[model samples]
Target: MNTRPLLEVEDLRVSFPGTTGEVEAVRGIGFSLGREKLGLVGESGSGKTMTGRAILGLVPPPGRVTARRLAFEGRDILGLDAAGLRRLRGARIAMVLQDPKYALNPVMTVGRQIAEAHRAHGRASGREAERKALELLSAVRLRDPERVARAYPHQLSGGMGQRVMIAMMLAPEPALLIADEPTSALDVTVRTQVLAILDELVTARGMGLLFISHDLNLVASFCDRVMVMYAGRILETCRADALSQAQHPYTRGLLASLPRLDRPAETLPVLARDPRWLDDARADA
Candidate 1:
């Protein structure tokens, strides 16, 4: 087994040029991902998705992304040009965006979409691509894979849409999968099903997973490790089992804010904000 990390990011920074000045969205965050599930938990504006986008070189114009080290499968992605990044995006590292409604093409059949993704990285005939697409759909637990493949995105529910997205992402058999809130838009039942599909796929394929979301409890239960971010910086990083025992106040507050069925608090406590949590501790250390 290749024991080295599939994805490594160190001292990553993303800044946007605003009228007032520069606004740093990702202020020097570092973490590594192997062939295991890693969760990034934080509130909005914490740079979770931005960090994933930066990994794929998806940051929009006027936003600058810089990193001391950014590598995937031992290849340095930091300096990769557009063509190189495109090859790496779906072939080496695939991403599942938050909503499939926006991610999928309305006019294209689900099978065509997945087939296109497969063909993007390698050569495949139409029949071969369709066969692979149906197999991918089946892998994600989609019922009646052939029918689902022929259906359009609008014909499917949110959960099914997400499943199609997952199938497409998995079609190329990428080494790393970055899922940014892949289930956030679905209902509780659908969300669990979608997450389970993702978990099973990652485990079965031994692919590295970067699950980005603001739900701390989900992260705690689902991921091997959890990274808590605040104001574009990591507040704490610890094993999933140790999340409740996290040392940082910010992480503790986040865990406390979640509604727990076992504890059954009358009212969940509000998270207290602290500017000091965003300070660069690496410099002081």
Candidate 2:
């Protein structure tokens, strides 16, 4: 197994100016990723998404992002200008948002969008780009590539729309993919199907996958390693398969709060928080 680091992050932080004070969305956190699945699990506002956005240079205005180091393929991305960020985004690093309805263009046909993305990222164009679009659609495990490709965003089901988004992202053949709650909106069956496709793609393409989700169990099952995030900081990181053995109080609280079928409980316990975890720079569990 090639365990070389494909992406590196150090002392990453994101701040937004507030009326009262500066609000830190992502406190100083650090980690590295290779050609493997890394899951980030946290509450809605726990900085999981913020970390991804800062790394990609997608943080909106009034949102200040700083890091000691953020590099991909040994290249520092923090200094990338708008054009540099544009060139870096889809061609080298890609992000798959949870909702395809907002991610996909409602007016454009799916095939056109995918083909254009391919052409923009690479030198392929016209017939070649169109062919690559179909190929990508099929690669994403979507059936009837021709019919589906011709359909518009609103014409497809939620699952199909998400699949199309994945297909479009794959057009660039990105080395690192940030999948933020990619299957959260799908039904259980469709969720499984999409996850399977992602697993296959990651293994086949030898790319790094940064999976951000709130589903602790799902992340445990899917990813090789996991990072638990809280109030702008990573609470703990452990092998995904060994999440049940996590030592941090926050991670333990999270696991204890989940209802289990095998060991059923009358009520899930509320997670107890400690303020000290947020301030401790040495708290990497």
Candidate 3:
């Protein structure tokens, strides 16, 4: 069995033009991901989403992505040309975006979309692609696969749309799955169901998952390890179960800001920011 990491990043930076000058969205961040669930948690504008997009070659033009080393399963991501990146994406690596409505085609039926995804990467015959599309819908625990498959994107509920997106991403059986806030739009119960399906699929397939979200507690419970980001850099990383014990001031403050049911406070505590935390984020990590 191959023991190498599925993804490796070092000195990764993403920048864009600002009014004054170039503004770095993702500071120099580095980490390796194996075949396990790893959570990237941070507040809005912390560069969590930019980092994921950079890895998948989805960063829009005018955004500069640079790294000393950015590799996926031994291939240099930064060095890959457009065609190479396109071939790599959806086949070797798949991303489940935050909103399925926008990610999926509006005019196509769900079955055709999934079948297209499968056929695009897997090179399956028309009949085989359709069959696998239904199977994948069932795998995501979507009831009445046949009926759901025939429906359009707008016909499905939030949870059902998310499940279809997951099924679409899984069509190629990619080695790495980048799930960027896939559950953020769902209600609590539906979120739990989607997470359960993600867990089952990732575990069964031995796929590396880069789960990005702003929910620290949710990430702590769902992932094996966690990385806390702030101001475009990772401030701390630790076992997900031990995130409460994190020593970084930023991590601690973020945790304290959450309103816990057991702690019944009238108001949640506000997170206090320190300039030094940004300066020392790399060292802390």
Candidate 4:
């Protein structure tokens, strides 16, 4: 039984060079993920997705991802070349984007797209890949697996499309899964179902899960641990159960802003803006 973490990121910084100057999207974020599901919760520009993309080496040109230490399953990923990163992307680590519409190809059948992902990671052949794809769809609790496979992205509803994306991501059986707002586009009922599927898969496979979202209540309930970020810096890291009792000002502010079910107010609390929240010097040290 290896006790080491599956992924460890330390002092990660992602910056983009612009005409005006440089924009630092991620500023020295650090965390370790093991078999448990971890949530990164923040606002839209909080750099949660950027951190996930940096791990996959998906940062586009003009943006540089630098880290003192970035390891996946005990291997240094920061130094991996394009080929190495590609090999690692779907094989050892996989990502489920926020929207399946953009992630999936319009021209390709859902089954073929999943099969291509499997083949890219050296998984199986044509027949075997189709079988595996159906199995994956079934795992995600999708009905009519064969029919769904033959359908295109446009043919499926938002929830179904997301399930298809999940199936494709899980086909490779990666050790780590990064789901960026995986259920954001779905309705409440479908979102619950999709999250349940993800929860079961992670627990059954003992895989590390990086679940990123802006919904604090969802993250608090779903993830084992939670990392609250603001302006690319981690404000607090605590157990999910302790989220309501968070001590950081930013964390408290976020909680205050969330709509309460039992205690309804005429208006939701306004989020206060503080310059110190974005100060990396104070956040890091």
TM-score of each: 0.96, 0.97, 0.98, 0.96
Decoy 2 TM-score against native: 0.97
Tell me the spans in candidate 4 whose CA falls farther than 4 Å from its real position: 280-285
**What does candidate 1 score in Cα RMSD to the true structure?**
1.8
Q: What ranking of all candidate models by TM-score puts the best one first? A: 3, 2, 4, 1
Question: How do the candidates rank by lDDT, highest first?
Answer: 3, 2, 4, 1
Tens digit of per-residue lDDT, candidate 1, span 27-51: 9988889888899988999899899
lDDT of each: 0.88, 0.91, 0.92, 0.90
Model 4 weakest lDDT span, ten residues long: 276-285
On TM-score, the candidate that comes out on top is: 3
Error of 4 at 216 (Å): 0.1
Q: Give the C-alpha miss distance for residue 276 in model 4, angstroms.
A: 1.8
lDDT of 1: 0.88
lDDT of 4 at 158: 98
Model 2, global lDDT: 0.91
* Candidate 3: tens digits of C-alpha lDDT, residues 41-90: 99999999999999999999899999998999988999999999999999
- Model 3, poorest ten-residue lDDT window? 276-285
